[model samples]
Target: MGVFLETSRLVLRPFGAGDVDLLVALDGDPAVMRFINGGRPTSREAVEARVLPRLLRDYPWGTRGYWAAEEKGGGGFLGWFEFRPVEAENPAVVELGYRLNRSAWGRGYATEGSRALIHKGFTDLGVERVTANTMAVNTGSRRVMEKSGLTLVRHFTGDWPERIEGSEHGEVEYALTRSRWERTRQPPAAPRP
Candidate 1:
């Protein structure tokens, strides 16, 4: 499969037909799925029927929204990242998301990949804004968003079908705009004499 993006230690590639097992393994971890589904495992049937199809679908902007993340040197499947447009015909605003195996947590992969995607969106993908959301108590994910140059935009209650552990506190949205991002980008260093 063609690589969508690459960082120093990760390779983001398009999902393939043979990646069902990887998805199954990733969603099968209770610790990883805690905030998503109250520690429930996603059935393989659901992965094949719904999850994989959504990942495989191409957006109207001519790109895949989800990418399978892997370690640089054959370290194997870690999980996935999402950088999809909010509107089907407009690439101006996009949402960012990530889900990694328990083994990959605390390794900075989330922040690294998010930063790269934000940079790409702003520079090459005609994106004007990037946004992300997580359960209010998800401090780890919040930190990743902050590290990726996003700021808290709002806190609102989502109408989830089932209440997760932290649902009582609602959810938080973080965002970064192109103008803000450009202002924060480091200027080129002066040439030496």
Candidate 2:
């Protein structure tokens, strides 16, 4: 119905109004925001007054505020992931993204959640494509994108304030079209016959 998608180990649920604290904590981690903000922390007020509201306001649309990536085993929050239709003229295209705490890193949580979202985008949401973009230097994120079956689509530059070391190299976009996704999906093997 609303913003809830489930994977084997996660429940991607909507970010309630109360999740401001979570945002504060998440953005406070420098290593977590390293590639984006150059390891600076976003103020809690900024998260509450701006970011959280923007995410929460999008609930009615095909996209939700933010999906709280909760572990089904412990029912604990790992972070958040978002899969949403790009609001441009090309509305059928969705963007895939996640922001997780450092503690959640190296656990394949990003890959697992991304695969589920991609499958749903094609099979259930009638999405024509899924796209993700990040700094070219963010190899960790690039790996997740690649593992989700997206390929490098382009390299481009964007304006940034902090200007990390590799900003000059530009950013990369990885994308998967519906046809590509369908073609790449392998049929179930005959139970290892």
Candidate 3:
């Protein structure tokens, strides 16, 4: 029952065995999965057998893995966030990602939570860089990344196994280095006296 982190409006905690249904419902939303799995809902078997196991196993990453985001006051499930290594990439360089319910869309939860995680990663955690990727057509997600102080680093095509509707447009990567993030947090120069 490790609590990873929390923002003003959200609490990010670890997912447990009992959270399978939540993941299932979140993944089942077509609007939520529009870009992720091409609007294909995730099966219960996959959630129970594969997804839960993977999430449970990821707990060992300490504070750097997947987290279940919930409302602090109402305890409502918003979605999940991941701040971890980019699979074999530099350990100091973590990746920031999130999947929130379509109902939570349009609100500033995504940007708020992401900025908090980025601050934690650069300050409390040993992260030197943070990266995020999304379909080029996912302007909402791209805007969140930008609001979190990340800049467009690259745009490239992935060898995706499935050809989704917007896959032809390619993917985009956004990144923010610790130095850059720190600069954003620094207070402006004192009045030149």
Q: Ranking by lDDT, best first? A: 1, 3, 2
Could you tally the backbone clashes for each prediction? Answer: 0, 1, 0
TM-score per model over all chains: 0.94, 0.89, 0.91
Candidate 3 lDDT over residue span 10-98, tens digit each: 88988887898899999999999999879999999999988777666542245437889998887789999888877644557888999
Scored by CA lDDT, what does every candidate get? 0.90, 0.80, 0.83
Report the lDDT of model 3 for residue 164: 90
Residue-wise C-alpha lDDT for candidate 2, range 52-153, written one tens digit per residue: 876765532455635888887667778888787776434478889999899889888898888888887788777888999999999999998998889999
Candidate that would win on lDDT? 1
Q: What's the true lDDT of residue 158 in model 2? A: 88
Once fitted onto the true fold, the runs of candidate 1 whose alpha carbons sit more than 4 angstroms away are 186-193
The ten-residue window of minimal lDDT in model 2 covers 184-193
Model 3: lDDT of residue 59? 27
| Candidate No. with top TM-score | 1
